[model samples]
Structures are given as C-alpha cells and as structure tokens.
Target: MSDPNPSPEAFRQMASEYIEVANRQGQDAYVGAVATAMLHAGARYAAFVAASNSPNKTQMQLSRKTNLDQITAQFRTYLEGHYDEHSENYDSYIKR
Candidate 1:
C-alpha cells in the first residue's frame, strides 16, 4: 500500500490513537511501539533531508544511501546498548 502523507493534525490524531492502543497493551508494549515509531520516523526524516537538499539525482542517491546506512547503524547501536545501565529509561536511547 502507498504511504499516507498525513497533515500535521492528522498525524497527531493518529499518534493519539496509536498511543491509546499501545497503552491498552501495557507499558512495555507502549514503549516498544514508540521505539518502533521513532525508528521509522528517523528513517523518514533522513529520506526527506536527502531528497530535499541534494543538488542532483546522483547526489540524492548518494545522500540517501549514506543516510540509510548511518541511521541503521545508529538504530542497531541503540538497540544493543539500550538495556545497559539505563534499562529504566527509553528516553536515553531516543536521545541518542
């Protein structure tokens, strides 16, 4: 399916609905859902930056490839280190 390009208000509403559903599943579920959402958001943000600022098609592709690699590495690092000395705070990983 094609991704929906939601308006800011629509995005807020969808987030609220997702939060409600996640809340019903308990804290861990909510945290996991939020973490997943953040990972996707980071990727989308990177893609947007790559698309918007690159001067040409070749540069755009290069930017996107580099951004994807960096984001994936960062996400993997976050996942691996998230439980160390900071298992109590998901924000620590998010902040990274």
Candidate 2:
C-alpha cells in the first residue's frame, strides 16, 4: 500500500517526475497544452479515488460537489502560491 501521507520531499519528487515528462515532450508541445493535460489527469484521478473511497454510488453522487470543491480549492491555493513564486522570476523564465 502507498503511504497515506507522503513526506514533502516525496511529494516534490513526484511533481518533478511529472515536470520531467512534460519537458521531454519537446518544443512541439505547448506549455498550455501540457498544463491542461496535467489538470485533466489530476481531476480524473481524484474522481477515481473519490469513487473508490465511497461506500456506494449514492454516497459518491452526494459527495461529488464537496469533493470537487475541496480538490479545486486546494489546486487554487497551490497554483496561486506557485504563480507568485514564478512571477518573481517571470522575466528570466520568459526569456528561456
């Protein structure tokens, strides 16, 4: 079984792996497209997890909005933090 809660280092490592894969897609893949794919994959996986953890279809249906809200809120927070961090180096990043 996977750890219920991974350490911060482990979380960063996982994120790095995803970034590596996105980078490996080469110049042909637009950054926006890659980001969209990642977002879709995250939402798909979250839905699967929610369904798996629910006792039944009715429970899953009942909790769908709450689950979605929680996931999106977490994503918003993380995105905002990272956006701020990157904004500090926007010029250098844009030049790359």
Candidate 3:
C-alpha cells in the first residue's frame, strides 16, 4: 500500500505550484479574488473526492460532517501557522 502519510516536501511542491499559478495571473487580478477562487476550487475538489470514495450518496452524506470537520481543522492549523509566521515578520512582509 502507499504511505498513509506523505512527506512535507510533497506538500511544499504542490503549494509552490498553486502559488505559481496565482502569480502568473498578473496584476490585473486582485490577490484577494484569486485567493477566493483557489479556496472555492479546493472545496469543490474536496467534495468530489469524498463523493468519489463513497459507495453511495447516502454514505457520502453520512460522512459529510466528519469530513468537513477534519478539513476545517486542517485548514485552521495551516492558517494559524502562516499567520504566526507573517506576524513574526510583519514589517518585512508588509514592505513586500
């Protein structure tokens, strides 16, 4: 079976690719709008994955709350870490 837990490097590379796409969109797009679009895309893809893994619609519905909670918690943790890092270097980040 494949590893249950993937490496941080794998995640970093995926994140970098996402960021690169956002960067390539150019200054014509508002950063907040782009971020919102990415968030929506993530949510839609997550729902698709959950549905795909379930044997039936009822099973997917039954697990929806659990899946949502897990995803929300993971997002919170990631957001907190990034928030703390930015807070630590607020001056430098703001200047960028």
Candidate 4:
C-alpha cells in the first residue's frame, strides 16, 4: 500500500479489525490476524525507514522481520519488531 493511501484512520482501522477478529475468533483467530497485522506493520516500518533515508533497507527489513523482544536485548527495541507490537506476527514471541 502507498503511504498516501494509508491514512492514520486506515491504520487504526486495520489494527482495530485485527483485534476485533481475534476477540471474536479467540485463539483460533490469532494466526490470520497476526500475519495480516505484521505485513501491515512491516510496510509502515519500511516506510519509516525509507522516509528517514535509511542507508540500509536490508537491515531495516531484517529489523522489521525479527521478533522485537527476541532482539530487544540484542538490538534497540521498537514496535513492529515484536508479535504483540505486530499482532499479525503470530509465530514471533510476543513480549509479556
């Protein structure tokens, strides 16, 4: 999705939909919600890196790929880097 297309409200709506789906579906809904959320979150993260003029898109992408808490002690932590932070990342370990 393009930066101009993803308004703040759209982001909020995506995040909200993830939660709503998860709640309605319970643990069973986690996989789908997390995956969708992670992609969305990753896209936003990549955009940030792009806007910040990051010299390392690969690293930014890798940073966006890994679990936040798993890498927190290893790398500076931020949102989208973790499961809960990226509710769509069902396979990643979420920070408690």
Candidate 5:
C-alpha cells in the first residue's frame, strides 16, 4: 500500500503531536518517530516544488538521488531548528 501523501501542515502537526507524546511517555522511540515525520513532510514538500518546476509535458522522473539528498539535507536542518525549540520547551510539554 502506498503511503498517504500529506501536506506540509499535516507533517508539522504530526511532529508536534509526536513530540508531545515523546515527552509524556519519556520514550526515545517517540522522539525518533517525530523526527521521521518532520523529515518526510519536508521531503514531500520539496519534491512537490521540484516537480512543479519541470517544463516537460511528458512523463519525467520526479526525483533524482542527488536532488533528493540535497532536499533531505535542507529539510533536516529545518527540522533540527524546530527540534531545538521543542527541546527548549520540553519541560512544559512533559508537565502536561
């Protein structure tokens, strides 16, 4: 089965939800899941933008390895920034 294609906002919400879960549960597994969700959302959005920019009307490859790698890196950096913010407010989340 194919994964549901989720919007950027969907991913953001997922990340937030998972982070809260992680804090509440105090589980490393939930932390990983949250990060994965954030990265996937970022990558999906990047791929959508890349495909929209293509001029070809015919069937074309939507993703190349290098391009995806670059996109993932950018997304990782963006996710890390959010993670930092979450970490800062982690105590509040845990208290919930």
Candidate 6:
C-alpha cells in the first residue's frame, strides 16, 4: 500500500487541474505556477496581484507558510526547477 499523491508530479497534476480553472480569469504561467502551488498543492488560500507597473514579482505572500509544510517544500522545489513557462513539461501540465 502506498500514498498515490506523495510525489510532486502527482501534486503537480492535481494543482494543474485547479490552475486550469484558476487561469479562466487568472494569472499567466509563471505566477500561475506559484499560484497553483499556493492554492492546490500547498492547500492554502492564495491571492496574486501585481504592484503598479511592476513587471517583477515584488509583492508575493512571503510571510505566510502553508500548514501542509511537507507539500509546500516539495511544491517550492518543483517551482524552482520548472520556472520557465515554455518548458514542454510545464505547458503540458498547465493545459492538463
């Protein structure tokens, strides 16, 4: 017996599904990746917003931490490794 969702890819798929919905009126892929992590995998409520004319992510939820700490650690690793929007893996996951 095993936990099916113990892997990051599994979490990614689940979170990506939620993100497809999130993207209906949502953020672009980079921040969307972060948002998906925050919302689904991290299992925490998240809000994504940009500062006035700031192209960079200058205002993110830095202080808060997910109660699901293990999932959050894995999700953060997944995020750093796959930050590029054009990555085929990410695109596939995002569309799925």
Model number with the top TM-score: 2
Q: Clash pairs of candidate 4? A: 34-87, 34-88, 35-88, 68-81, 68-82
What is the C-alpha lDDT profile of model 6 across 1-96, one tens digit per residue?
Answer: 558447888877976886586566455457656665646633533223112223444333332343236446766986776675447567567565
Q: CA lDDT, every prediction?
A: 0.71, 0.90, 0.88, 0.60, 0.69, 0.54
Candidate 2: residue pairs that collide = none
Q: Which sections of candidate 6 miss by over 4 Å?
A: 1-13, 27-41, 45-69, 84-96
Off by over 4 Å in 3: 1-4
- The TM-score values for the models, in the order shown, are 0.45, 0.90, 0.86, 0.29, 0.43, 0.34
Sort by lDDT, best first: 2, 3, 1, 5, 4, 6
User: What is the Cα root-mean-square deviation between model 5 and the actual structure?
Assistant: 7.4
lDDT of 3 by residue, 1-96 (tens): 666566999878889999899877746798889889999999999889788879999999999999999888989999999999999999998865
Q: What is the per-residue lDDT of model 2 for residues 18-77, given as tens digits with 9 covering 90 to 100?
A: 889887764678888988888889889989999998999999999989998998899999
State each candidate's clash count.
Answer: 0, 0, 0, 5, 0, 0
- Clash pairs, candidate 5, are none
lDDT (Cα, 0-100) at 22 in candidate 6: 59
1-96, model 5: which lDDT tens digit per residue?
Answer: 534687889888987885586566545456667656755766688778777765663432644666678777886897799799989999985666
lDDT of predicted model 5: 0.69
> How well does candidate 5 score on lDDT at residue 64?
66
Return the TM-score for candidate 5, rounded to 2 decimals: 0.43
Model 1 lDDT per residue over 8-27, tens place: 89888976885586566556
TM-score of 4: 0.29
Q: What 10-residue stretch in candidate 6 is worst by lDDT?
A: 44-53
lDDT at position 91, candidate 1: 73
Candidates 4 and 5 compared by lDDT, better number:
5
lDDT for position 13 in model 4 = 97
User: By summed lDDT, which 10 consecutive residues of candidate 2 come out lowest?
Assistant: 22-31
Can you list the residue pairs that collide in candidate 6?
none
